[model samples]
Target: MKFLLTSGGISNDSIRNALVDLLGKPISESSALYIPTALYANPNGPAMAARLIRGETNTAPFPDGFTSMCELGWKSLGVLELTALPSIDEKCWLPLVKETDALLVEGGDPLYLCYWMRQSGLADLLPELGRETVYVGLSAGSMVMAPSIGEDFVGWKPPTGGDRTLGLVDFAMCPHLDHHDMPDNSMANAEKWAAGMPVPAYLIDDQTAIQVVDGVVDVISEGHWKLFTQE
Candidate 1:
């Protein structure tokens, strides 16, 4: 599986280059299927980011959206709101997903995203499609891919059902650490959070991302992040 797990969306030249290179094709030749379902449950955010995830759209109140990709100098041909897809009919959404070179998952509520992923059946299709495409995850998008989104994991409470993550990654991620814009997150809080986690945790900020290609893991960022664990 090739994944660019970022605290924020692709925000720098290095991250964009890595995604393009991972696709093994120039951005012009590649297409993406933008998935913004995580925003569906946010109280203050938009119900849908934009009808189209393209260069000329406004993200509005949402922290990230099509405009995030545009700002990073990247582009995509397909844009989808996972919330809009018919949960019972995979046929309605599968083709576009298969046609894309990348799948960009947005940030917000991790459990909410997970619930829809399972409901839409994308959760099952993902393991197979992931082998052939780049999975770009931002914040909550990155958190859901982990084995579990436990207590204090990713700076949020676990969903009502407990650790309901996709289990794609071995560790949990607590993103937005010490981010000046996110006042509640800090290194001190991260340290306290890490000490109680059952597994290793990654504390990342907006400029930081955890890039996992195949089985190799690397920390890529213009800012600082830390690996915290009871181990």
Candidate 2:
């Protein structure tokens, strides 16, 4: 499977160019699977996020031109609002993932999102999706694609309990690059995490992304993306 993982959305023109380089020629259509439920805790957050996802918000949003990717054919999907567990499989889960070309998960609280992913059986369902779909995880989305999550602000931190992640991707991903909102010394902490690790690691920024195709991993863009490789 081909994966395009990013720290966050791209708003810079140069970054946009870089993304097109990574994505290669646009397919006839690409479906965006937006998991707004992952960001549903705040009353206004989900709705507010929709506009941003729909390209109706954000001062310097991911550029108006990219909308053509959606307009010309890319179909954006995160339309259902789910709150209950049973509602997941029946009402929102199955249909949302049915015919997707790519699953684009936006950045949100990884904790809550991961919780929902487990509860909703998405963790189990993911590999099945891999049979045909390319999973594009951004920020919190990307972090959950790993075996275990690093300490991150937007996602849930395990409380007295531990659950190994879905383990689809062999590496752990940390988002936000050198941003102050994260650890005081981000690279130092990342290095510490990698000290005894056996697989490659990646610390990404909003403008950066990495594409994992077949078994080869390549730097798709580095505007703000950095790969720790050993952590």
lDDT (C-alpha, whole model) for all candidates = 0.73, 0.58
lDDT of 1 by residue, 46-155 (tens): 63455224333453332432236533434555567766675447677788787778888878789888877876778888888756688889888898998777666433
lDDT of 1: 0.73
Best model number under TM-score? 1
List TM-score per model, in order: 0.85, 0.73
List residue ranges in candidate 1 displaced over 4 A: 51-67, 70-76, 153-160
Cα-based lDDT at residue 178, candidate 1? 83
What lDDT is reached at residue 175 by model 2?
66
Model 2 agreement with the true structure over 30-131: per-residue lDDT tens digits? 565656555555446656466655566432223332231122235344443334645644654576675666666655666666777777676667766654
Residue 218's lDDT within candidate 2 is: 69
Error of 2 at 226 (Å): 3.7
